[model samples]
Target chain A: MHSFESLSKDFAAFFQKSHFPDQPASLYQPADYFLGLGGKRVRPVCCLMGNELFDEILPDTWQVATAIELFHNFTLIHDDIMDKAPLRRGMATVHSRYGEPTALLAGDVMLVVAYDYLNKVRSEHFHRIIQLFNRTAREVCEGQQLDMNFEKSETVSLDAYIKMIELKTSVLLAASLKLGAILGGAGEGNLHHIYEFGRNLGIAFQVQDDYLDAFGDPDKFGKQVGGDIMANKKTFLLIKALESADPALKAELDALLQSNHPDKVEKVLAIFRACGVDEWAKTLKDQYLSAAFQHLDDIAVLSKRKEPLRSLANFLVQRDY
Target chain B: MHSFESLSKDFAAFFQKSHFPDQPASLYQPADYFLGLGGKRVRPVCCLMGNELFDEILPDTWQVATAIELFHNFTLIHDDIMDKAPLRRGMATVHSRYGEPTALLAGDVMLVVAYDYLNKVRSEHFHRIIQLFNRTAREVCEGQQLDMNFEKSETVSLDAYIKMIELKTSVLLAASLKLGAILGGAGEGNLHHIYEFGRNLGIAFQVQDDYLDAFGDPDKFGKQVGGDIMANKKTFLLIKALESADPALKAELDALLQSNHPDKVEKVLAIFRACGVDEWAKTLKDQYLSAAFQHLDDIAVLSKRKEPLRSLANFLVQRDY
Candidate 1:
């Protein structure tokens, strides 16, 4: 079985050699710029692994992988605009560097280009692939809407938050794996199993992201630790703290959440730890990881063939960044 | 041949009976609101007419038509945000009524829904339809970018302006007809003919819109006469005036274009007439219409079968509103 590191290297090489149209400098330059600002490329790598697990990596699989990457970047561009985020990947965000209109168009063109790649798949696979993509795309938008709604919300249930994260982050990852499996000629049952594996893995990944943001070493994490806390973002940590705190502590937590306290991150972390929210988050992450592994085990593929995915999942669960 | 009136009525019924999902209220509501505001339904009608000109209207034809309509509205919503326009179809624009972020998502979901409709086409037609749609979609973005670029530009050539409008306004209309033609099982030659027909007709329609904006009576036009002139839009007339004017008259025209003169519309109109730009615009519009008819005539289908499209073209040419 190929290691995750090898698969990621292959994805990087393929992406590096990929050609994005250079004309319409206004619409595409920003796309090129954003795509060049590299991330971990997790979704596309998962897609490749999904495909390779069932069959030899097909040409259409690469196309699907690239399309998913583009789609992810498209979401990032638009989400940054909505969130007013200044940076992505330690660089200026698309909307911040390019004006909002250009960023919007760039994001839009990315979607069109992504579909263009998907359209290149064989006709037999085209309809199902496009349908899955459209449904997932709509769900992502709905998830973004729900996330925006949460900003003004007074209290958010853990279930609602989980649902939002599932829609926003998990489903795409799930769809990515299913699409790859579909291209790889996996059975319907296997498709569902791989999708569930991806979905649960994505949730665990996001919860871990929240945990890392508050508790991780800043140097290793490669992001500002407690940035979410400083912004009073309704992450899993904050929501759990709100839900589980006693009245006096709840009032204190609420005041801190509402305040521009310079030490807000420190204060919020203390509250979370004091309330056992930190430990709770770790437990939640572990539960999701276990569920993900269960789904992975349920797939009918040989355990040897699944080793790459299993190892990748373990790596994700233990990653510092 | 079906009458344009009947085809349009059919389109209206189809659109009215169509269901857009009601959930994700933030995302879909603005889409519904935008689609609900009735325009002429021109693109979809063209699609239907294209379908009827060849074969019986197939299920896929309506899907293509709806996809085109949705795509057009998607462009409108995003364009409104970019242009900061306050109105569309005599109502507040999507971004104006819904906030920019909601409007952005609405446009995005509309595109997804558009693809969803396109996805329903038979796999035989799916790849070609999607490829064409993607190309046209990218061109539209480039065209919008060029239009925005022109806002900061001091000089825009007549050719450049026409190219921008062709990309911005013409291709989708062309693509709509071509998609319908493809679904109707039209030959490759006929598809090209119909696409050219739509393209030339769209350019003529836009030039006429510019003409009516400057020359038509406001009561008949149903829009403010000289609104483009008031906004200092670089219409066919304006560009031609700039290209053809004598030095003294050119200086005067340039000064008037730059001024917020109360009688700016009258002054610009007078200058355009003096420089024969109005005449040039009419001649250009006529040239496009004639070219459109030539393509329509070239279609191997019987002339009688082509009457609906011809009639629609004529109505577009003579439209005051």
Candidate 2:
């Protein structure tokens, strides 16, 4: 039984350096600049943990794992351009520092290079792997499009938002787990259960992000809080608030939301508290976490090997920032 | 043998129809808007022609031929954004009409779906086909980056621009031909020679674009002459003009380029013509065409089957519009 903590810690250092070919200069600096921006390596870690649960190791495991990282960074680079985000990992966003044209092409090349690594997978499994890669890649793009589409619509239903996030964010996490299982020759039933666990956890994790960005403590959060409220973005909190609010409360919320002043953040937070929106968001987050655990429990693996997966999910949902 | 005329008519008509799942309604609306604006599908037609030269009665050949067209449209969508070009095919460009964000994502998805077809290739040849696709994709990105870099710098050597176009534009054309050849199961040696032939022809085609944009008939060409010069773009004409001009001539050309006045197009055209820049550009275009022909001659296939390819290149190079 490997604790997910142990697996994650190992995979956290996953792809610590370039694994294939003569590397090129990042053209900006540190070819791994964004790569080193520490993500939990959560998705790829799911891959390795799934592999371990199946008790198999494929050589060039790093190739696929590193590819997940490449795909992730590539998405981030383009998403930053779309989101107009200025900072990532406490550094200037690639588009902000290097300009959009460079950022776009850098992201483009990273995706192509990701395939270069995938090409090295053993021939026996190669077709299945490439098929998985293609399907996952398309889902990620579809997810992104849906995410963008959510922004333009005047109203987004809570269920639709969850589905959007699940596709946009969770499916990659799901794909990461499934990919490792396929590589490890895991049985079909196990792959199905593992995918469910990863997808549910991914949704829970993003709900955590939405909650943390709004309600997190200033110092502990590691960045400014209430970014969702400030951007007037319709996250779980806002969508729920919109759905549940009485007419008067809804009017007040909309007014505060529409205000041009900086004090709008305080006004909205005050309304959310008065209406119990904060508690509601927290309760929903916990509900997702509970559902994810049930899915994890349903996996055929022994209780012991699943412990790590459970702990990782708990850590994510319970995070302060 | 398919005549160049028949090949162009055949592939363009084939590509005009809709295929593929998950394409946004807005996706290839630009293709219609752009493709309808009417430049020759010379590269794709060459792919079909090249494939037939190796073997007649090509199987499900349209799919491979259409993939090349899709890839070409992907490049144009992104390039129009980068160039900030207001028009294509003599109509409003994708970015200009649909807005940048839509153009960006639609272009991204177009590439993904390009591979969706590649995945549909017969299982035996799929690996080889995808590897070629991956290599071509990366080179195109590198070529685009180098091009963006040139826009910021003063000196863009003719050799540098040639290399840039080779990656940016030519290899995809080469790859298109190779993709068809691979689908036809042409020998590796034959594929390489065909690739060279297509690549050189692409370079020659681009040079012809530069030549005509300056020197072609404006009424017949359906656009302003010397527009690239007016924008101070680092096209071959400007590069040749810069390289060939004396310091006094260089200063005059530079001064004419600096003021992008309405009259400046007329002024730059005068200087370019007076200095024989058009003739220099035409001479290079002819040289590239000759090189392309020499490569075509290297092919083991009989000259009879090769007529469509040679005429296609000539039609592309010699077209007034």
The candidate maximizing DockQ is 1
lDDT of 2 by residue, B1-321 (tens): 779787777776777655445343454454455545556776667667767887873654566666666767777888888778897766788889977766776676667666666656554676676688788877787788788888888898999899999998889888877877776668878888889888888898898888778777888776677767767888988888788888888898888877767787777777777779877777777787788788888877778877877777777677333
- Model 1 per-residue lDDT at B256: 93
lDDT of each residue in A1-321, candidate 2, tens digit only: 566667667766656765323422434342356666777777777777667676755665556877787888888887887777899888888878877777776777677677777767764666676677777776777677667778888889999899888878988988888888788777788888888878878888888788778788888778788777888888988888888888998999878777867788777778777778788777777777777787778778778877767777777678333
Per-residue lDDT of candidate 1, residues A1-321 (tens digit) = 577899889889988853457777777888899999988898998888888889999999888899999999999999999889898888999889989999999999999999988877873677888889899999999999999999989999999999999999999999988888888888988999999999999999999999999999888887889889888899999999999999988998989977998888888899999899888888899899999999999999899999999998988886333
Look at candidate 1 and tell me the lDDT of residue B282: 84
| Highest-scoring model, TM-score | 1
If scored against the real structure, what TM-score would every candidate get?
Answer: 0.97, 0.90
- Residues B1-321, candidate 1: write the lDDT tens digits: 678899888889988853457887777877888889988889888888888889988888888888888988999999999999999878999888978988999898889889998888874777788889899999999999999988889999988999999999999899888888887889999999999999999999899988889988888888999889889888888888889999999999989987999999999899989998777778888899999999999999888898888888888896323
Interface RMSD of candidate number 1: 0.9
